[model samples]
Target: MGKVTAQTRLANQLLLEAIKNPKNLPVLSLADWELLIRMGRRTRLLGRLEADLSRIGLLAEIPSRAADHLRAARNVIDHRNTLVKWEINRILWALNGTEAPIILLKGAAYVQANLPPAHGRIFADVDLLRPEERIEEIEEKLSLRGWLKMQIDPYDDRYYRVWMHEIPPLRHRERGTEIDIHHRILPRTSRLNSDPALLFEAARPLEDSRLHVLAPADMVLHALVHLFLECDPREGLRLRDLLDVHLLFQHYGQEQSFWDGLTPRAYKLGLERPLFYGLRFALRFFDTPIPQTVRSEIKNAGPRWPMLWLMDHLVALAILPGHPDYPYPWATLARHLLYLRAHWLKMPPLMLARHLLYKAYLRSRGVRGKVDLAKLDLRQQ
Candidate 1:
């Protein structure tokens, strides 16, 4: 690991403390407030910051400048969330006659369910999951409703169709809102055996809507899998995602059934390891209230001590924001390593090597407009 300057440590620590306890925030000096806002914004947690403070009634006491930044972040999320609901309504309208079930995923799920994690959450696009057999039908319906696949390299498109969990993203012609139609939680080629059938069987419906969401435990596991297994390192580790895990755990952990069922569900989906990592980090960063018995059971799913130790360091460096002007070299190294680790976890060795070589070849040839190659769904094309 590269050296971390005291300034960086202090900055990271302050941001973390504020997240853990927003009530302590009103005491921060102006200079500290500046650091907090920058780190929160970089981590996409500024709106979350606003939400947390407001939840605890501390938002009104925050310094005016900091509060302004927080409110602005919240406003952006509010607008995006409004658009998300409208998009989903339009999606339902488009698929009115179709009998296939559609389930909201990630940000859209959190919002529609009115989960705690959705409070002030910023969304870039909407995500949906449907049965694989109905994927083509869903895509067709959306296309007729003005949603079209994003143009990309033919190879990449083939990759998505062949190996990915979702098709190439679809964007509406009029609103320009993007939607990812997924058939499963993980890629078809991924090592984890996350069966969409299991998810669909357990999904719960929304009130006054045809759409559904994963059951509570499934929701938590999906968030963790996305956090620990499916992240694009180019985007860095989102502290916001970890915060989502924290909030999900916080809300769901209130029920004994949620705790009892979580680990078993993860095992059923071949996602125990991600569940372990999610719990470990959420506990570490947010002091999430997990039951001791649940903690003991999850321990069996963790990596060995040496591997766990190494992962702790790597995750800390990659997830915690450094100074926006001077990011730590070790943090960049950690992101790249995690990027490679994600691919290793997702693909078999031979296929991974081939896919990576092809991607490297494209980059070497000055492929500027290629989608973030790290995020591809590999294909023979």
Candidate 2:
């Protein structure tokens, strides 16, 4: 492991210890408290910290400034929850006549299912998945209901319609919340496009509505795939993503069936690699409890010797916080490698080359260097 800053240390300590045992928050110096707050904000863990601290009455002991941050984060989360309910209701109303099931994904699923991870989690969009054939009708209905499609160039539009997993993001003109409509769990161009029907078959409906969430095992797989293998690799480094994995383990791992089914389900999805990496880091970082037998099985199922060794080293650098210890030269290089690795895993070389070239061309033509997830209020995984 690389040397990490005291700030990262304090922040991580708070997260791990508090999640495991909320009553046992470590005592903090003023400087440590400041760093904890800063790191929490950067890693999207402030709301989580606030929730855990309050769970055991330690929220009051935090420094005033830190408490202020916690309060602000909680306020944002509460507001987001309110907006989420409104959005869900609107979605139900829009698709009322259709029999297509509106399956919520990611943060939306966490919130809808009342999962432990959703307690203080935030979301910028509501992700909806229906069977592939229903997508066009759903999009048309949403459009009729005042959700406008995000404007993109013709090429990018075609990229999404033909190649990507989801439709162009749609934002409600009145409510201003983006909703991603997906017909599949992953991009059509991705290397591992498992039969989406498998996922659909495992979904169970939420109470009193058409909204559905993936089964416990599928939910874990989705989170693992999202964090470790899909979307932005930098996002996997976020403490909140790690914490989500921890919470999933804490909540669902209590069921012996959850453990028994995990491996087989992951293989069925063609996602054993992501699950392996997810479990590896979740255990390493948070000491997530896994049955010894299951752990042994996963170890036996994991990547081969040198590949595992390389992933351990590279992942440690890529996922750990970058800063005073692991500076830009080294830490940033790890991020670059992992970022490209995500792209390589998603698309074939020829397609990836063309995509990167076109993106570079756009950057040269004064398009932003990259879309800032934070600025866009994106809550990926």
Q: lDDT: which candidate is best? A: 1
Worst 10 residues of 1 by lDDT: 372-381
TM-score of 2: 0.90
Structural similarity to truth (TM-score) of each candidate: 0.94, 0.90
lDDT of 1 by residue, 1-381 (tens): 234566678788898999888889999999899888888887888998899899889998988989999999999999999999999999999999888667999999988889998997898899999999999899988987888667678878888999889899987776879999999988888988777899999999999458899999999889987887765666667788999999888898888999999989899998999999999999998899899998999899999989999999999988888776566888888888888888888879998999999888888997753454334442311
**Model 1 off-target regions past 4 Å?**
1-3, 368-381
lDDT of 1 at 350: 96
Query: Model 2, 1-381: lDDT tens per residue?
Result: 334444445445654564566555446667766665666666677788889888778888867787889889999998998888789899889878998688899898888888998987888789988888988899999888878777567778888899888888987766778899988877888887677898888899899568889888888878876776553544434557777888998999888999999888988888777888888888898888888876766666687889789778767666655433234345566667777877888789999999989988987899753243334532321
Pairs in steric clash, model 2: none
Q: How far out, in Å, is residue 249 in model 1?
A: 0.7
lDDT of 1: 0.86
State the C-alpha lDDT per candidate: 0.86, 0.77
Superposed on all Cα atoms, model 2 deviates from the true structure by an RMSD in Å of: 4.5
Q: What is the lDDT of residue 203 in candidate 1?
A: 94
User: How much lDDT does candidate 2 score?
Assistant: 0.77
Clashing pairs in 1: none
